[model samples]
Target: MSVEGNPGRRLLDEDRLFSSDPSQRSVARRLYAEIRDLPIVSPHGHTDPRWFADNEAFENPAKLFVTPDHYVFRMLYSQGIPLESLGVARRDGGPVESDPRKVWRLLAENYGLFRGTPSRLWLDHALSEVFGVQERLSAANADAVYDQVQACLDKPEYRPRALFDRFKIEVIATTESPLDPLESHARVRDSDWDGRVITAYRPDPVVDPEYEDFTANLEQLAEMTGETTSGWKGYLAALQQRRGFFAEMGATSTDHGHPSAATADLDPAACQSLLDRALSGAITAEDAELFRAQMLTEMARMSLEDGLVMQIHPGSFRSHNQKLMAGFGRDMGADIPTRTDYVRALRPLLSRFGNEPGLDVILFTLDETSYSRELAPLAGHYPILKLGPAWWFYDSPEGMLRYRRSVTETAGFYNTVGFNDDTRAFLSIPARHDVARRIDCAYLAELVCDHRLDEDEALEVAVDLTYNLVKKAYRL
Candidate 1:
């Protein structure tokens, strides 16, 4: 399963993220050496499970690296590179680039657009480490690199299952709505190949009153789960039924991607009134937000009962680009992080379950200002809460460093789960995890150098941060 390195042509430096200081760099390298090869426990992600179920060869580099990945296209898009030219399919079946080589060339030609971004690090890692392209990608070598990756895609060892094993992923969870059939996950579970692919229940389609096809999604949920949606209780029962089904399909967690961390604990009558308005398509924006907030608390209650870890990643203003959304639909790299408030927003849910010994709630923030001020103090004191990794816009080297410095003094290492890539770019999974591990090693080295922590303690914390905590927190 080994691909020979390109030797001098590697895009990644051997000590890419280690400290620049000689003494601290040595310590970071020593700490990273032990846990760098640990099996990736991807307890949360957005990889397509069908890749493992069907075990098909990835079609091409453009499809794998560019089209589906918002991180890649968003930058290209920001530079005025039309998504259509990058082979992003239009919603109305409009003509886009049919040539994969053309799309890949756009990435290579505009490679400098990603120069200071994590996208650059990940793409280069995939190019040299995975495909052995040897040299930096450029317009000059675009087609040649495209051909090389296409050749690899056609090979047996580069198929999804083979690459999953090659990546050393112990288990990976793909997010799915409660209304999803999970046939892909079912196929992987029923298959003989034991690459542990699982699902996480993302109830946004059903819980978020503002979700597209809101009423229709409820109908589908009711029909699929054989529970009524005529009343608030029936809707809850239907969602609960779907959660049970997802658990049967090997789900260990439930994920909520709400717009904010707001939560509400309301009476049954109030819940029913909001449900009626939502179902009738007459819910006000305020009511819609309240409904979403209440649902988080309900989901937390369900998690306590079902033993599914709860993941709340709030503060994304989804589909920010109106024109792009109309033509290309959601997740076209248009989801922007908005200013978020967690302290008061999460009070309702935390007031109820914050001290529950059985409840495991991982809180994520798009708002970094809350790291030390709100999120760390919350996780530091609350038994139910744990800080998720530095996420979304801030998952880079500097971002990870900012997160550790902000939260560690208050929440400490145990109050935070290890890193989850949270990506649609499947090839970058290992690269993202590798970046987190390296940043952690570098951070731990600083602590050792300052004498705040002993070298031995830093090493143990590195392993915990790199691997163990994710498994424990996510129950993977």
Candidate 2:
């Protein structure tokens, strides 16, 4: 019932995630106060557009917190809890625990599994600050907390659109495939809600050969645009048409989640041959990778024409656990970080578009090793390249600190975009953003104390990192 006997009586410390030195922590507190409530410029994320469009109340706490977030369920799965028990549906529509209270109890009991994790910080923040649940979640209080959150969800003020406005999100972008009709986006645009929900073009299904139903995706693309997708020129035309369509539906960016940061610039005939092989479904793994690489360059060129910002998220060996993938399908926390090469891998694309001033390409990596050695140098030099915020596995306070330390000296602040939540859990957006702002302010405080930066400049940089940089980078 009470958190008094716990290690910390208060669920969150007012000075959490700050410097140890009193002077620097004081500076951090002041800087955080300045920009802590700035509007979130969420240029890229995975929150469902349908929620904001429909303005529906979230079903329950377990559905809101456990089922949708891979960060939550994957950690529970690692501790030997079946995903089905946590209400994660299987691809075959197999039986899963449907009782939300049971799922919440399981998560609350195993909350210790997330003790030192970003998930813990986010969950605690969401519980205490968002829902006004001050007591630490445990098996004893799980039902009480669930009932409180469910009661909040039932209120008109707690619906998706209401929370979007409450969160002060300036502009949020949700990713969608080329085959998607974007009816949800149109609904958001046409509605009187006034929440800015836009879409980002993710052409993986049609671009990546290893994607399931690649040929079928191409055929669907042909049907979507009246182009013969069998031919190379027609395929390109179809993609360009879809980009235009997405742009019309309020999309300002394109996202690519390739396995590697590979890029290629093949001749026209060779490109046609590769396209043929890809369409025939007779391509090898290497061929698929090469085709994907060439498509990256092609997309870059198209970005120049359409003015959609490009984002490349690479170096994840996706679906690393074959059994989980086979059971639950993709994006179920099985994606593992692998060694990524950005210097050589991006050379081909950069060679062609490196000098193009009109293009904006944001590079994201799961490989932290590349941040200082490759990504920072590359971003510092190229007109088109800018480093994305700490992403996927690295969207933590420590990871953010590491990224700022690794890239800021070489690339400078301007060469890096500000934070993007990149999340599926709607409730976690504010918590994630809060963590980033606190960590960034702390970083600025350290720089100020070291006499490397003046207080005024640090304050300005703090505002930029919190709000201005993302808008400018994403052209929001």
Candidate 3:
């Protein structure tokens, strides 16, 4: 492996995301300069906690970038690239590509598929900033780039914990199910390492009746907590027990990836019947949705009691490709966004807890239409609600600009939490945050250029967006 690259070629521009106008670009640069070195606050995400716990070297370039990131594989998959070639495992333990270099070559050969996409930005950022690979990835340079990144991964400084500190992460939260033992989080907590990696309770498997192995998951929960699942009260108690244990492991929040922002405040007898139907395998699609909806309210109530920030990102039609799901299982980038109605859907929960100052419910949406129309208005009015950053499908430069334009007028700055990478690609964390900070700076600069906001005030708001709001809203 060598640093041999195209002569005089640099992958990223110094002022990549700033305005083209001289004065506005100057303002953006000043704001970015003020907050560019701030510690990353990743409040909710899907990165595995075991990376920090085990403190092991990453496997290879392909596994590091291509295989685990849906953002990468999904774009390639859209261009008729079989996921098998990219090392996405089959559910029946069937064979797929095993050679990491081969996989990396495939991505490199088709690297143009990612051009003008956020995936390209993140990949290039990671390669250049993290590994010092200055050349752009291509079929010609794939082997060189692969070897270059692999050599970095072979070093102790590139280990997960070391990279955590090097990335200047103040604290990052990994999402976990109630059935999870939090062993990795426990290991991180008990180790001498000072890196802060905490867990967030994600109870989709136990709460959503239509989840895969739903009954079996509940049975496992009962086994873990010694509470029966046959009754609603006992099941709630078991969930509380798991939440308590997660809190003890340093969780500050609970995350929900429901299909919609639906909520219900059903009575005890109704809840008992719903539980019976759900457990007995007679749950209807509507009933399953209701059960999930009611659980959102219930989780909000529990959040008030235990002080965990509640998070919901609704409106993804997850696992949309049945064939892909059957072979590869869930979250293989088959998820598509669906229109979500928050005002009507959240009424049940909002009516009960909308006024509570103790509750903090952070809302995210795959549907950008909600940012101005639904989310901003709701967050602006509700004391307990806070808008999350542009998320999931919209974590790109253009998408982020759209989000700021849409939300700031109604929700303003304080009604929202700041940026979280929300990624499984560990290396992309810093790149993603860099994109956010730059985008926020660009947006603030635009406001200052238009005389809508003062330059000094915009600089202060930039710091809050990069650091302060995330800490306050997620209680991190």
Candidate 4:
């Protein structure tokens, strides 16, 4: 019952059914065995670059495991645990937990809240494989598990760079704002370290009018790029310049986190007028959205010219909890998934670049219903469009399975980019990637067993889907 007493054992019993049939289960096990130790290709994620740049030993288990993870905190929040108690830092400089072990106990007490959730799978995997915890994280074994993890984390082997090497991560991408100077990225490059952790250009603050301090962010972008961000043409040029700067820093892609899957194809004059209204702060919510939509099209056009991959992650109702958002700020696990429409919303952008062979736009959605209805069909036909793997809310085992089942018929394995562990928790990278590979193997096993695909074909597709597809998709 204690992690210290019986180390190096699995939390769950082997009898647990991840797959239904014994034959398919065997195939899945074999398939997982092949890529189980393969190098991780984390093409897109939200992990802090400073962790790798600094290469400092993590302070404690709770801060490393519980606090920063939205999946962990959101579940705790759903069970009536205040975010402030879980050591979630406030944006307005309010007080929060300073004792990491106390936060760990609170999370351990409420661990059952995530029993059937993906968080449980990730946690168990991290505990067993990463920290070598044998016992399950119940209230009884919480302290023991915490102590063991804390002890291990205090070691130099558990440092970010060491773990990156131990995890066999080939490349990891951290998202960065346009205003960021990428000093950490520069440090990573200049250091003797061989780990390939790159930055992704996220232009939300400069592009999205609703983003906090949008005006100031625009001024900063202008200052960095020496382009007049006040005008429409100069704004676009500034963005292009910043994107080039990111490209030089090893960025192969640009990410847009828009509110919806909206896109527009406004002419130059209309775009300038919209920008003027937005700058004057006279733009309505609807106008702001339209401008964002138009920017998607503009970004795609730029991608076509520059050869950088484009990623659109739309349909998040970000900061749903107004109080939590106001107190703790963004990404405190208050963001909820809403139904996203891709068909009509992306028509403008697709119409302009859908047939273009030079452009590559990978689409990720929070709405599962759109997988077969919108995403698959779009990716199936458009030369420029490719479906990103199950993302964010849907980046679970069942979610990945659902994605394969739903989209495989139309988009196929080649049309879809392989898995990307888009996580902020650095330690969970291996666990998340493991879950994805397992689910994909299970899906392929099912296909092989059903006689839909031969064993040889399944093996090839599994390897490609797990490794090659992602590398090619992200231009790695």
Mind giving the per-residue lDDT tens digits that candidate 4 earns over 107-198?
88888788778888888878888888877787887788888998898899999999999999999999999889999999999999999989
TM-score of each: 0.98, 0.98, 0.99, 0.97
**Model 4 lDDT at residue 422:** 88
Candidate 1 local lDDT, 360-466, one digit each (tens): 99999989998999999999999999999999999999999999999999999999999999988889999999999999999999999988999999999999998
Clashing pairs in 2: none
Give lDDT tens digits, candidate 2, residues 229-308. 98999999999999999999989999999999999999989999999999898999999999999999999999999999
Better of 1 and 2 by lDDT: 2
Runs in model 4 deviating more than 4 A are 5-9, 12-17
Assess the local accuracy of residue 161 in candidate 4 as a C-alpha lDDT between 0 and 100: 96
lDDT of 3 by residue, 366-395 (tens): 988888999999999999999988898899
Model 1: which ten-residue window has the lowest total lDDT? 1-10
Badly placed stretches (over 4 Å) of model 2 are 2-10
Better of 3 and 4 by lDDT: 3
- lDDT comparing candidate 2 with the true structure: 0.93
TM-score of 1: 0.98
What are the runs in model 3 whose C-alpha is more than 4 Å off? 1-8
As for candidate 3, its clashing pairs are none
